[model samples]
Target: MRGIGYSLLAAVGAWAFWPTLRDLAEKWQHDPQYSHGLLVPFFVAYLIHRKREDLKQISAVPSWPLSLLFLSTALGCRATSAIFDFLPLDGLALILVLAGAVSLIQGKEMLKTVAPALGFLLFALPLPYSMERWLSQDLQHLATLASTYLLQAIGQPAINEGNVILIDEIKLGIVEACSGLRMLMTFAAFATGITLLIDRSWATKTVLILSAIPIALIVNVLRISATGLAYVLLREAPERQNMLGFIHDFNGWMMMPVALVLFGIELKVLQWLLVEPEKLERVISFPIRREMPEVPARKAA
Candidate 1:
C-alpha cells in the first residue's frame, strides 16, 4: 500500500514537471560544458543506495505540514516561472516537488538524512550566464599567466597577452572553453562524492575538498605547459597543428583522472603526516612479517 502511494506520488510529480525535465535534458544534451549534469541524478541515486542500511533502521512517518509547505513552495515557483517565463524557476519547482514527495512518503527525518545528496543536485543546474562568464575569464587569465612563466622557466621564449600565450612563433590561446572551468566544476563535484564515501573526519574531508582547487590549477598549468612545449618542438605548421589538437583533446579528457590521482596522493600525504611513525612503519612493512605480533609459548611446553 505504501509502495502504491509512492508510485502515485511519483506519477503526479512526473506529470507536474515533465516540461521542466525536458528543458533540462535539452540543456544537458546541447551544452558541452554542462554535459556532466547528466550523471548527477545517477550519483544522487547511488548516494541514497549507500545509505540504505541507515534508512532501513528508521520508520517513515508522513508529515502533513512539511508536505504542504513543500507543495506550496513548488506552486509558487511554478507561478513565478509562468509569470516571468524563466525556465530555471520551473526546474527549481521540480526539485521542491521532489522534496515534497519525500516528505509525503518518508517524512522529514528521511529528508534530513538525504538532504546532502539532494543539495548536490543543485550543481547540476547551470550557473547564470554572467557568473559563468566571469569565472571563465578569470580562469583563462590564470592559466595563461601560469603557463607563460612555466614555459619561460624552462628556457622557452614565451609571452602572455591577456589569455594568449606566445611561445616563439606559435600562439596558443587559452579560450573560455579551455579555461579549466570545466575541470574545476567536474573535479569539485567528484571530490564531494568521494569525500562522502570515505570514512574520514570532517577536517580530513575539508582538506580533500579544498585540495581540488590546487590540483585543478596544477593540472591546468601542466596542460598548458605541455602545449607550449609541443608547439616549440613541432615547428611544421601541419605537424604542430595536429599535435596541438591531440594535446588539447587528450588533456581535456584526462583532467578527471589526473584529479583522482592527485586526490589519492593528498589523502596518503594527510595520513602520513597525521599518523605516528610506528604506524607508518607498520604500513610500509606490511606482508614482510617485520611487524607481526609475537606468539606466547604453548601451555603444554
Candidate 2:
C-alpha cells in the first residue's frame, strides 16, 4: 500500500510529459527519413528494462524545487518551439523526457548514472527541419563533386552540374535523398548508442559522437563515389540513366548495411585513439597524490 501511493504519485506528477511526447510525434511526421521513429517508445521501454536492476537498487529522493525547475524549462522549450520551432536540438527533447522519467523514478544522482546512455539515444531523433534543409544542400553538392572527380581520376569523361554528375553520357543526380545525410543520421544514431554503452567519460563520448558525424559524411561520399563509378564504367549509352533508380529502387536497403560498416570503422578508430580511462586516471592522479601533503586519517563518525 505504501509503494502504491509512491507509484501513483509518480504517475500523476509525470503528466507534464504529454506535451513533449506529442511534440515528438509532430516532428516525426514532418521530415522522417527512417522508420526508426516508430521504434522510439520501444527503445525507451528497453532502456527502462535494461536499467531495471539498477533502478531497484536506487532510492529516489524527491526535490520539489529542482523538479519544478526542470518542468519550467520544458515548458519554456515548448513555448520557444511554438515561436521558432528550432529552439532545441532533437536530443534536448530526449533529455526532457529523461528528466521527467528521472523525477518520477529517482533524482540527479541516479539520473547522472545513465545520462550518457540516454543522451546517446537522443541521436535517433531527426535533425530539425530547418537545419536538415541546409545540410541536404551541402551534402548533395559534396557527393556531386566527389563523384565527378573520381570519374575523371579514372580517365572517364565527366561533367558536373550542381548535384547532377554526367559521365560517359549517363547522368546521375545525387538527389536530395541521395545526399547520404539520411544514412549518416542513421549510422550516427547507432554509433552514439554504442559509444555510450562502452565509454564512460564525457570527454571520450563527446569525441566519439563528434567523430561519428564526419565519419558518416566521408562514408556517404564513398558510397556516392562507388555508384558513380558503376554508372560511368558500366553504362555504354546516354539512355542508361536508371543507374540511380536501379541502385536505390530497393537498393535503398543496401544503404543500412553500408552505413553500419562505416560505423564499425568509426568504432575501431575511436578504440585505437582512446587510451583506457583507468590508465588516464592513473596518469593524472599519480602525480597529484605524490606532490600533495597527506592528511592524518580521521576516526569514523
Candidate 3:
C-alpha cells in the first residue's frame, strides 16, 4: 500500500510537469546538437534499474523537511522564471519538483538512491541560449587554429582567420555545428554513464571523464583538417561541388565513433597501468600448474 501511494505521488508530479517535459522533448527533437538528449533518459532509467535491489533495501521514511525544502526551491524557480523569462528555469523547476516528490513519498534514502540518475538528467536539458553560443564560438575558434596548425605541419599551405581556414586558396569554415561542443557534451555523458556502470576507482573515473575534453578536441581537429585536405583535393573538380557537402555530413557522423574508439583506447591504457596484475592473471592465466622440480637430483646424489 505504501509503495502504491508513493507511485501515485510520483505520477502526480509527472502529470503536473507534463507541459515542461513536452517542451523539452520538442527541443531535443529539433536540436541536432542535443539529439543525444533523447538517449540520456533511457540511460538514467537503466542506471536506476541497475540499483533496484540496493534501493529496495532502504526504508522509505517520509522526509517532510527535505520535501518542503525541495518544493520551495521549485516554487522559487517558477517565480524566477516568471520574472526573468528563462525557459531553462522551468526545466530546473521540474527537476526540483521530481526530487521533492521522491523525498516526500520515499524519503531521503530513496532520493539519495536516485540522485545520480537525476543528475544525469541534467545533460538532457538544453543549455541557456547565450551560454551555448559562447561555448560554441570558443570551440569553433579552437578547432580552426588546431586544424590550421595540423595542415601547416603536414606541409599544406594553410592560413586561418577567425573560424575560417584557407588552404591552397580553398576556404573551409568551422561553423557552430562543427564546434565539437556536441561531441564534448555527448561523450562526457557517455563517459559518466560508463563510469557509473563499471566498478572502478574514483581516480580512474575522473581521468576517464577528463579525457573527453582532449579526445573531443583532437577528433574535431582531425575532422577540420580532413575537410581542409578534402577541399584542396577536390577544388578543381567543378562537377563534384556536392562532394564537400557529403564529406561534411560524413565527418559530422563520424565524430562520435572516433571519440568512442579513442575513449576505448584510454580505458585499455588505464586498465593496463592501474589494474592489479593479479586480477589480470586470474582472468587470463591458465590454471596454475605444478612445476616438477629437479629435487630428484639430490636423492641421486
Candidate 4:
C-alpha cells in the first residue's frame, strides 16, 4: 500500500514534468558536442552485465521502508523549488525520489544501484538560456587557456580571447554552443552510473567518479589541441577545404572511446588492488578449556 501511494504520486509528478523534459531533449539535439557527449550513457549499459552475479543476490520484493527516504527528499526539493522559483532542480529531485522508491519496491540490486543514470538522463535535458550562456562562457575561458599551453608545446604562436583560440593564421573560437563543460557533465553522469552498476566496492566507485573531472579536462584539452593542429595544417595546405570539419567530427567521436577504455583499465586496477576474498575467521571466539566440560576419557570408546 505504501508503494502504491508513492507510485501514484510519482506518476502525477512525472506527468507534470514531461513537457519540460521533452523540450530539454529537443534543444540538446541541436548541439553536436552535447549530442556526442551522450555516447558514454549508451556505453554504460554495456557494463551492467558484469554485475549479474551479485545482482542475483538481491531480492525481488524490495523493502518498502526504503521508499520513505526518497519520497520525503523528493517532496522537499519540489517544495523548495515552488517557493524559491527555480527550474528543474525540483524536477530532478522528483525523478530521483520516484526512481529510488520504485527501485526499492520492485527492482533488484542491479536496477536500484543505478541511481546515477537518472542524473545522466537529466544532463541530456537542456538548460535555460541564461544558465547555458554562463556555463559556456566559463568553459570557453578554460578551453582557451588549456589550448594555448597546448599550442605553445607544439611551437605554434597563439593568442587567447575570452573564449577564442587564435593560431598564427586562423582562429578557433568557442562558439556559444561548443563549450566542453556539457561533456564534463555528461561523463560525470556516466561515470556515476557505471561505477555504481559494476563496482561492488564503495572505494572503487569513489575513484571512478573523482577521475571524471580530470578525464574531462584532458579530453577537452586534447580536442582543443586537435582543432589547432587541424587549422595550422590546413593553413599550410590552403587546399583541403573540408578537412577541418572531418577533424572536428572525428575527434569528437574518438575522445569518448579512449576515455571509456582508460576508465575500464582503472576499474581493473582498482579491483586487483582492493578486493580480497573473505578468509575463514581466524579470531573467532572459542570456549576456555577449563570452562568446558571435558569429554569422558576415551576409555568408554
Q: Against the true structure, what is each candidate's TM-score? A: 0.85, 0.73, 0.87, 0.66
| Candidate 4 residue spans exceeding 4 A from truth | 1-14, 27-76, 79-85, 96-135, 236-238, 268-301
- What would the per-residue lDDT of candidate 3 be over residues 121-176, giving only the tens digit for each residue? 88888889999999999998988898999999998989998888887667887888
Instruction: Rank the models by lDDT, top first.
Output: 3, 1, 4, 2
For model 4, residues 60-166, the per-residue Cα lDDT tens digits are: 67755566666677778767867875556655665667565656766646455555454555655445558877877887777779878888888988888777787
Structure candidate 2, residue pairs in collision: none
Cα TM-score of candidate 1: 0.85
Top candidate by lDDT: 3
Candidate 4 accuracy as lDDT: 0.69
Candidate 1 structure quality by residue, lDDT tens digits, 46-159: 989989999998788998899999989999999998998777678778888878878888898998889888877876877667788998899889988988999999999999
**Once superposed on the true structure, which residue ranges of model 2 sit more than 4 Å away at CA?**
1-34, 82-98, 199-204, 233-244, 279-301
Alpha carbon deviation, residue 85, candidate 4 (Å): 6.1
Among these predicted structures, which one has the highest TM-score? 3
- Score each candidate by Cα lDDT: 0.83, 0.67, 0.86, 0.69
Native-referenced Cα lDDT, model 2? 0.67
Candidate 1 regions exceeding 4 Å error are 85-88, 274-301
State the weakest 10-residue window (summed lDDT) of model 4. 276-285
lDDT of 4 at 58: 66
TM-score of 2: 0.73
TM-score winner between 1 and 4, please give it: 1
